[model samples]
Target: MDTCYLCGGLLELLGTLGRLAHYRCIDCGMEHSAGIDNDPTPTKERTDNDTDMENQGTSDSNHD
Candidate 1:
């Protein structure tokens, strides 16, 4: 049985095409592809506007 790298849950084999095997996590329901170097963890790139918004929110809360 294969385990999911992100959630460590049981992985179910959906199907295979050529040399690639697809899998789906039963616990998290996340789909994964075998024989590939794909990262499942999501990431967001922070911009200057995002930082400014966070600072504004912090200052607004302090004013009250």
Candidate 2:
């Protein structure tokens, strides 16, 4: 698990593509890159999980 540079807390994986890693600070909602060291192998598709998450519930703006 990566750590956030801004908050000094464990980072949560937000998204990624190719060798680039995207992370967010769970505590502060800040997005940043996770340094590329042992780049993971390529996978089939991206954004599928994101779509699932979005479709599963109403967005924050839609809530009353």
Candidate 3:
């Protein structure tokens, strides 16, 4: 299962909205969304690199 970015907890799929897949952390209750193209499988393991890339993207978007 994919791990939560905030708390490293197991993430459960809440549902999908069009091409977006939504998840919620079981531990911290933090919500996350992934594009179906980016993540073909919701149960895929999340790596540290994935987290870093996501964080980088978020930071870059903040500059816009």
Candidate 4:
């Protein structure tokens, strides 16, 4: 049985259309299409303003 590579839960077999099959992560709501490589997480681009969270220790967005 195929499981979600991301969430590690049982993958739901949507249906086979022609030569393609689809699957979805029940936990994370990530979708996988048959003919495409599955990227589980959103990729963040490095920016000049980007810094280590441990070093910065805070965000500009206020908690209040």
Candidate-wise lDDT, in order? 0.70, 0.63, 0.74, 0.58
Candidate 1 C-alpha lDDT tens digits along 1-64: 6778878998887887776777888998778776544433322446899888887845444534
Clashing pairs in 3: none
Q: By how many angstroms RMSD does model 1 differ from the true structure?
A: 10.9
Any runs in candidate 2 off by more than 4 Å, and if so which? 38-64
lDDT of 2 by residue, 3-63 (tens): 6666766777767777678776677666776446752232334468878886885656753
**What lDDT would candidate 2 get against the real structure?**
0.63
Q: Which residue pairs clash within candidate 4?
A: none
Q: What TM-score, computed on C-alpha atoms, does each candidate reach? A: 0.54, 0.50, 0.55, 0.45
Per-residue lDDT tens digits for candidate 3, residues 1-64, read 7887666889888999898988888997777788876642334458899988887745434534
**Cα displacement (Å) at residue 48, model 4:** 28
Root-mean-square deviation of every model: 10.9, 12.0, 10.1, 11.3
